[model samples]
Target: MTTTHEISADCKACGSCVEICPNRILQKDAAGKVFFRPDRLWMCFRCGQCMSICPSRAVMIPGLSYETDFYPQPALDERAFDAFETLAANRRAGRSFQDRPVPRELLEKLVEVIALAPPSFPPVKTELTVVADPALMHRSLGLMIDLYDNLVKKMANPVARFFIRRQAGRETFITLNNHVIPLLKERLPDLKSGKEDTLTRRAPAMILFHSDRQSENYRTDIAIAMTYAILAAPALGLAGTIIDLIPPAVEKSPALRALFQIPAGSEVVGAVILGFPKRRFLRGIRRPLKSVTWL
Candidate 1:
């Protein structure tokens, strides 16, 4: 028996597959049709580049191992660990922010870095929306406060009482907003002291990462990309907050979705409010590491 192969009629003969294939196993027939050169299949490395780079998505590999099974043993290297520690140590929840806006060039660079993050599955479909306007930031925060109030009212009586007293005299909404606002103030003293007037006073920019729920790795891809942005922001002298409070508002408010032009079938998975860090870090703090055991 011999292996069989075929191409879809939708193939545009773009030569992308031909150019990308490491093995010369595919050739164009007289009608500009792609075909497998039977003998050349021996040279195929199973790299699947042809399928991955196909713009028409017409390439299919039969009997392909869709999962990556190889796992290298963990090897601890002090230098590498130290390098990572330095990066993590530099990441502080910035509270105070400078009035000066973050440079467009820096934002662009950070996005570029985010684009290189690894996705959990192929064909990652994540989208990012950048909101730099201070007015828009305030509007988003206001909407979040509204949503918080709505949820607070719906909470169980016991839970509601717990939170009400836990808030220490602040309104329930303010208490919820305080989670981010306090961090924002600590990183941005000027904004905290009313020297600057804005919800994200120090942050001249914000980025919202969205992904479709249908994507197999939507959550993973969105989280990875957002984390990359968060880590990269500090290197650019910027601070950011990943807002979990915004998505429900996106779901409940059509006006909010339209304001951001988020497409139908897409959902806001993550949001990062970014700006220059006004507060400086003196050193890293130690945290207790627990909940791990060797089998």
Candidate 2:
């Protein structure tokens, strides 16, 4: 296996790396120079705190390059918070989209912002498949509708319903039986006949977030990444809604999986559908959280 750390000769003996390392893998030698403890090297989650704090730029992780990986932090001001508040307050779930496709450049910008999402650990396991074409989005919505239709049929059978309940647990089973099934049944004919799209809303683009099943925090990471994408979309002349309807369909069908290029064992955690809003909201609605108890 390749080594994880490399301490160059330019070490200034500042002890900054030693103090900032989360795992305390860096230690000061007799001359007070920094050195990595080989035994605890595996504990380093590559959070990059040491490298980010090191004044001498002497520390480098194997997979990270100082020249390419590090960038100067932007200056922050009161306007930053004001801008964020405005964005958050103005946010709306865009279910209605214009009949125009999102440009490839804007999609690339979205991916760039996604890359900056804070990871739960050193390396982010979340993978994104960007479907930039409206035609592909339509096809994907069709696949999702098919899956929901099939699910409703299977759920009608007692034996299959029992098995589904056991596999999906009580909460999910209840959600599907009471909410999802009824909704899908109502829209199935319209969806099949291309009269409407209640799920994907015929968005110009979509992004699927998936990760390996063995990832430490795939769900949390994907959620955060998805939030980042949603928030960044408006600034790029785009708007979107986070949709959960597509992942199950994508996961079950090999054709859908192949179309999205999701790896065989990976789980598609979430999705975001993006496009220009057919209409814009003039005001914001305030929906507070259900509970906010102070400790």
Candidate 3:
């Protein structure tokens, strides 16, 4: 059927599409024209090479036919590319945020830009929990602290620790008990009485990403979208940091999960806290890649 391919009479058989075919699924007939063989129709991937390269715009794909669906983005020149590198290098894990909350309009615009970012083919979607309100985030952080406190008490007991180790594996439980729990406990007073103000590090906003249980590539999808989200933030004069500390606790405790507003039947896979940074970084130190094995 014509479901997967369509070429209007506007096609000039210029071979632009033919040259760009990644799968080589399209082949020439005796007329020196391009057509996908019937057997190879099953292999057709909607990568949109044909549509993108077609000079006449004769080629069409579902959901990509509209004029607004495609646009010409010029390649970054040397100066633009250098600016990109600089922004990337200077990207900081901003734990300390200014007391001012991110403007709702700015957050809305950021989300709008991220919505246009690509996901994998048949991409799994993620649900975002945006804690934009300073008051709301404060309340939620308090609740999260309470839930984590209860978990620490349970994990501290020798009998409880043994069962947890058995269930969550020894190294995992040990890390929770030895490292994560103690740190939270030390900060518990500051968290509880609101004295220290470093509980969630004074972030004015937090964005939590969660995936539905049914998606097979939940983590991958969440991570890819998260990369887009964090990258987009710095461009708007905002900053973001990937959050690993919260998800582990949220995954383990139902109350914590609920406190973070993780939807039922979905799990928090990735998260980030975002806000205006207190101070900008002038230069960034490099962390070189260690293991390189080129075949």
Q: Top model by lDDT, which number?
A: 2
- What candidate 2 gets wrong by more than 4 Å, as runs, is 1-4
Backbone atom clashes (below 3 Å) for every candidate: 12, 0, 0
| lDDT of model 2 at position 215 | 82
lDDT, residue 247, candidate 3: 73
User: lDDT scores for all predictions?
Assistant: 0.68, 0.87, 0.76
Pairs of residues at least 3 apart in sequence or in different chains that clash in candidate 3: none
Ranking by lDDT: 2, 3, 1
Candidates in order, TM-scores: namely 0.59, 0.93, 0.84
Tens digits of per-residue lDDT, candidate 2, 124-201, equal 899999999788877777787778888889998999999999999999889988988988899999998889888888
Tens digits of per-residue lDDT for model 1, 34-137: 87788887776556667666667566565442244112335778797787667777887664666666677887898888877776654558888877676676
| Runs of candidate 1 exceeding 4 Å displacement | 1-83, 154-202
Superposed model 3: Cα runs more than 4 Å off: 1-4, 19-21, 116-118, 197-199, 252-261, 291-295
Candidate 1, residue 209: the lDDT equals: 87
**167-254: candidate 3 lDDT, tens digit per residue:** 9887877788788888888988778887875556778887888878877777887787778778778887889888777676677777
Better of 1 and 3 by lDDT: 3
